[model samples]
Target: MKTRRVFLQRAGISAVALAMPTLNPLLAMTKSADPLKNYAQTLRVAIMGLGSYGTRVAEAIQSCTRTKLVGVISGTPSKVVEWREKYGIPEKNCYNYENFDAIKDNPDIDAVYVITPNALHKDQVIRVAKAGKHAICEKPMAVNAADGQAMVDACKEAGVHLLIGYRMHFEPNTLEVVRMRKEGELGEIRFFQGLSGFVIGDPTQWRLDPELSGGGAMMDIGIYSINGARYMVGEEPIWVTAQEVKTDPVKFKEGVDETITFQLGFPSGAVASCLSTYNMNYLDRFYLNGSKGWAEMQPSTGYGPIKGTTHKGPLTEPIVTHQTVQMDEMAAIIFDGKEAEVPVNGAEGVKDMKIIDAIFKAIKTGGKVDLTFG
Candidate 1:
């Protein structure tokens, strides 16, 4: 059977090569049909927020054939100046947060990738949507469910695509597991375990501030587990039970949780156990158990180079920058109406936010919190 790759090879052949099968070599050197061609031509993007993650996103985008960074928005004037010079962006393409709304008038920037602090995502995404550009926001998506809904509503009103920075949605190995589950290779999923955490070294970072980051490990790092639970089990949770433990009030602060253990009960009779913390290293992993088989992903939800295995075999997918694949796919999604292998829409993010909210409520009251996504 001729796949798309084979089709591209045949399309590149000379008339003589069409007549011969065994010895034709010219077609082999021809480029496979570039799936990103249309996106590469149409997607002009901007990076909002020039922080560490923003810088890395910008750099990763340079490798994306489907997207180009044409503008920048930053609160820090010095960083804006440096970025404009570095990317060769015209003066008209630069903006500060206060003046960013004027971007609605610019035609060059087709999308805005928001990489600001957690609390700022709601307002910033609203503004970006109003500016008539597609909104690609960093994860947790917002400080809480309410803010996530506001962002979603704003984008819906503006008729713009709202994509959260769930890079694993585009990751090859991770998506393979999702494929396996959908294919029934995992049979009926009965149990799942999601673990995500890190020893956040800087006590002064924004992640520790409840107002800025929304919550402690649960907000900043635990979301990986939350999302993993949903995707691995392939069902929306019906209820949540949680417990919180904190050892350092100085570092984690009041109104913030240092560590949390939560359980999610799915409608399919599958249950997930999750652990989230701010005092562990290389702590991202997932285990899904099913009637016929099981899958395990260690170093699963981290930034890159994921390693894992399943009942069938080991994950042999090559390592690539999660951000690189994400940006390219985002470009295609906005410009060509391309759907993600797994949805990364704002609605999907809001569902996770609702689960997080339930988890927090469960911890506060020491009771099971019911959840329903309709």
Candidate 2:
């Protein structure tokens, strides 16, 4: 087994407050939050989805030193029973989907982890924010950019933090890539290629439903490429153009895309080509070409054991549970207000959603779509 280091414990102040003596000025401001009176207390969390990803998140939280899964929101009573038995949660900590808003009065859960389907994210996040709890929503943030904006506004107005689950932002290898890029290791990056996809097995799965998933592979799996494009270049995209193809209309209904190949032009003159699809297998990879040398990550965006190499050499870091580290950092940010190396808040997520929206539009119009983010 590889040795792992948890960065959250080294934070000087309560994770909610980033004004430690060692923090840089820029970091202090972005991570600033009121110091919790109970800085040493455990931050309680509610797992809203009992699906595969939600189950995995619950398991990962068990290893967290500063967070606890104290509540749940599930549509299935059987899952509630199983979770209560597995996690030692009481019945009061369990809630059905319809009555979950009453969690405001429970006082046990400090935050709600919205891990449900893509379309359900908006309403659930709003309810969590309205209930005066912080929200940590899964990626794509919402079905559309407008809904994404609404979730951000709701959380900001409620004075609760809104975090998106971009686990790679906190992963060691991924961070190393960001650091190397910033340090000029790749030397003036000019082009990038991001490939993210997986073969869909079940035709009847929610991921195929336009209403439930918002879109097909682009919404479900292609987001990795969208996010990869921005972080790899360290700049926002300014324009986009794309094309979509669907060989099976029965499996991929109207409003659901099967595969999309898109290009992004950044303000810094960097251009990126990306592919997102559900018909391919083991396709997660990212490559960057710069004036001097290049960097590439194979199995870049998959769930763990990420591998990468640059012109200098391959990544030497060992693989760790990305979710475990992510949850720990989120706890520090939520309760102690610690600043992440990069922002993982709703704003960051909205920027990516904006790009995804533009990609779809560009595909539909067969013309370039310009984008701007504030």
Candidate 3:
């Protein structure tokens, strides 16, 4: 009866809509005026890193209607000057890493987007939380689960929102696939595969430094696969097993991983086989198979134009700028109480960190590591 009533109501609405062609002009005028309410609440953001990814995000933010880049936090003074000039940022809105705590007094800046190295996320995000502003940190939120939890606790205690930059969570093609899985367009999930990697050229960069990076390929490129597995399978992994392989000790060095192949077993008997590597190229892909249907993606987690196909046919979702959509959606989440389809909050980052911790332990022990997530 509930379904019948809903269907009848939809039919009535369709008939009214067809009959009310003249009403659309009035509706459009009303809709035009309604946008001013949302526009008035645009979020002012400060990005904390001046590196390549930070630059990408700053450029992407120019297109975001709901989120604006108004300030910057960088250790390099020269980059700060250049960015301020380029982005029309005022001197008062800028601060170096050592002095960013002063941002707490600046009411114009509402949030800080931390795009620094993996090891730096914990301290930086905690600081942002303590300043009584929201934090948006990049992936691999911390070096380990303990630090990730500490960031989560700090934000909770300070009463601020802590969001991880899981930009794919807002991507259209990715969301459509998740929607299909939830709507049973795909039946019970059986298996998933994620391959995320790239060849590293600069051996001297911060990404290769254990102190800054926390780990090698797994922390950098491998995280996408670990994150992708859970979202695609729609289940937290119960256990993980991993094996590591290193060819060049000179470049990779101690405490840094070169490549890892990990498996995640879910509670529903679903399993994931994934690979994370630094020496491999053209490895960005995700595949999911279920009892009734399958979806496959190549170049799955890249910056833009994430293409995919399902058992039905090609995924036809509109291609969108990932970072632009992400920031705008994040603005809604931080201010307007919007809930994402998959969580992009600090707890979600902690869950990924827990899996990474288990993966590293599994590599060292040559045994399976069990996981428990609430």
Instruction: Give the clashing pairs for model 1.
Output: none
Please report the candidate that would top lDDT against the real structure. Answer: 3
TM-score, candidate 1, is: 0.89
lDDT string for model 2 (1-374, tens) is 01112223432234444443322221211212332222365668999999999999998777665567999999999999999999999899899989999998988888999999999999999999898888999998998899999999998787778999999888778888888889998889899999988889899999899899989999978898888888989998999999998898898889888999999999989999999998888789999988887889998988878999988899877676777778767876765556787779999989988988898888878999999999
Show the lowest summed lDDT stretch of 10 residues, model 2. Answer: 23-32
Using lDDT as the yardstick, the better of models 1 and 3 is: 3
Off by over 4 Å in 2: 1-39
lDDT of 3 by residue, 1-374 (tens): 12433433522334433332221111111223333243436678999999999999999887665678999999999999999999999899999999999999998898999999999999999999899888999998999999999999998787778999999988788988999999988899999999999999999999999999999999988999999999999999999999999999999999889999999999999999999999999999999999999999887999968999999999887777788878878876665456788899999999999999999999999999999998
| Reference-based TM-score, model 3 | 0.90
Q: After superposition, how far is residue 258 of candidate 2 from its true place, in Å?
A: 0.6
**TM-score, each model?**
0.89, 0.90, 0.90
What does the lDDT come to for candidate 2? Answer: 0.84
Q: Candidate 2 clashing pairs?
A: 14-336, 15-336, 15-337, 15-338, 16-335, 16-336, 16-337, 17-336, 17-337
lDDT for 230 (candidate 2): 89
lDDT of each: 0.83, 0.84, 0.87
Tens digits of per-residue lDDT, candidate 1, 6-97, equal 43242343444334222111121223356335222446788998988898888877666566789999889999899988888888999999
